[model samples]
Target: MNALARPFSVAAEARLSSADLPKPETLIRIEDLTKVYDPKEGPVLDGISLAIGKGDIHGIIGRSGAGKSTLVRCLNGLVAPTSGRVLVSGREISSLSGAPLRAARRDISMIFQHFSLLSSRTAAGNVALPLEVAGVEKNEIRRRIPELLELVGLSAKVDAYPSELSGGQKQRIGIARALALNPQVLLSDEATSALDPETTEQILALLKDINRRLGLTIVLITHEMDVVRQIASHVTVLEHGKLVESGPTFDVLAFPKSQVARSFLSSIVAHDLPRQVSERLRPSPAPGSSPVLRIVFAGQAAHEPVLAALVEQFRIRPNILHGRIDYIDDKPLGVLTLVAAGGTPTLPGVLAYLSSLGLHGEIVGHVL
Candidate 1:
């Protein structure tokens, strides 16, 4: 979806208050996490480790076959790990089994991309299922369902069956059901992937609200960078069953020290261009023109006037072919590609000045 098509309202961009967020300094921890498909195929998750602070909205992202799903499955014992421990709120949950395992799981909740609610059951009935299994009184289930439905904005549809709801509505039902047991943590696996962009935003908003209202720690796995940027306070990037990077979303995104970080940088920075337009960009190797440079301007450097100063001072011309600015936690990071032309002797000075201004320029290739 085009970003300009769905701009945030002034109120929405101000940031919801943080007073209600969780304080679970270490609500969930994956220690030396490793999951192997078998002795034949080898380790699918390799020595991964991370921590989720209390009430933090942590996001895990990776491409298909990156072992993100495998890691999450091991957390709740849905998929057991070959080795290592998963401690939820400081209790080792990965090795638990039988009734103990079931009890541990009650403190954790997971939501799916597909609406896993029963088709014949009403939304209320479906939300009540988890409680029923736990042997909660029927009265308590009835009392809780309405509040849960209202929380996700699904109160009006409580009596409706799954077929009667839209994709987003169905997901809200899933969210309410997952919250049925009032677990300390919430797990969402690609929960908004199937929804439309507008619907996706709504659901994300709901999750953020839930995280705040309930002080619940959330760990979600997604392929969409937009999802990660939207609400994840911290993010872990995975690739080929290995953790490429993990840290606070704003921190990792601001510095982007790894290849995975570079991949995300490319996505957020280049997403603004039409694919065909981007294909037309390149460094020309012809004789006369200056270099085609890719400059990464992070944090405060995003607003520096280095280019203008260089062009005016050196009597050079710069054609800004493409540019984008993305924010993590309301601070901007910028990427700009330009065709630089000037006196050959001034190139080094210009590059040095750009560096001084906090923007790093790479002479990708010569432009004709």
Candidate 2:
């Protein structure tokens, strides 16, 4: 067996309990927020409540027309909520207007899906625009531009124009421009959607590096689960402008409770069995049928030899139908679908053994 397939010692299990960790400070809070564009169309954001912790890479995921764009607009005061409040750093963003709102927005900045850089401006000029608009002195703007470019690893491209730079480089310029105001929170609206897969991974890595180096809070809005799985520490699911699920990324990905979430995660994790395997499944057991088991391996359990144990201890032969292991936020998450032949009589004991090892096991169906 490989190192990852080795059995772990149950006595050495050391999962961290929630009570053991200090709670993170809340940087953004949405309380019963709603936005109505037209009475006939109903609210775009319906009674949504969510809290984003300081220094967290929070991901908001949903299908198109799910109100993701509307919620983000409400956060930075671009769109006012019909009712309820949005608090950022203890100040109500939903209520601010005019000069107050613009000033408050300095603490919150945004980047877009398209590289919103001016075609006429160079990389340094683009990064300097925000500072110039804020009325910072020429000397201060000159001093800050180099630092921002260096932060995004684009010092060499200082003189490059948007047309001259690649897509990833343009996004680096956009990110640097967003940070020009030294905002406390950064909002990304489908920032990586337009990039190719390799470029998307690079952009996500840059975002993760920025988050760690500067301790800046990031609110990432995307339709891709792989994007969230790559960097988000916390995740929230929205459906029809309502909050369907919210929690730590690992927990939500390991055992999703909502159908929308499950569907979204299908690409990242095996939420459904293969069509061939599923077609063979029967709701009830037959004379020579065997129980199909779906096992979820997470944390320490991902490295355990649970399948070997089934064969050794229970004499259960496992015919693995489908399985895959993926890492989320640097931790393992694995799902396996298998036929537990000759194990039906010991189903209860098999589940109990899995439970003792901190794994999730369910009898999905029977197959002959």
Top TM-score prediction, candidate number: 2
Give the alpha carbon lDDT tens digit for every residue of 1-368 in model 1: 36653334322332332335444378888988888877788789999888888888889999888998888888788988888889998789987999999999998899998878899899999999999989999899889999989888888998899999999999999999999999999999999999999999999999998998889889999998788888898899998888899987866776667877667656675423445444554555455656766687766566677777867887768877778777654455677777677645577877887877867776766555
Q: Rate the local accuracy (lDDT) of all candidates.
A: 0.81, 0.92
Q: Which stretches of model 1 miss by more than 4 angstroms?
A: 1-24, 254-267, 271-289, 313-315
lDDT value, residue 332 of candidate 1: 59
lDDT for model 1? 0.81
**Candidate 2 least-lDDT 10 residues:** 8-17
Candidate 2's C-alpha runs over 4 A off are 1-17
Displacement of the residue 193 alpha carbon in candidate 2, Å: 0.5
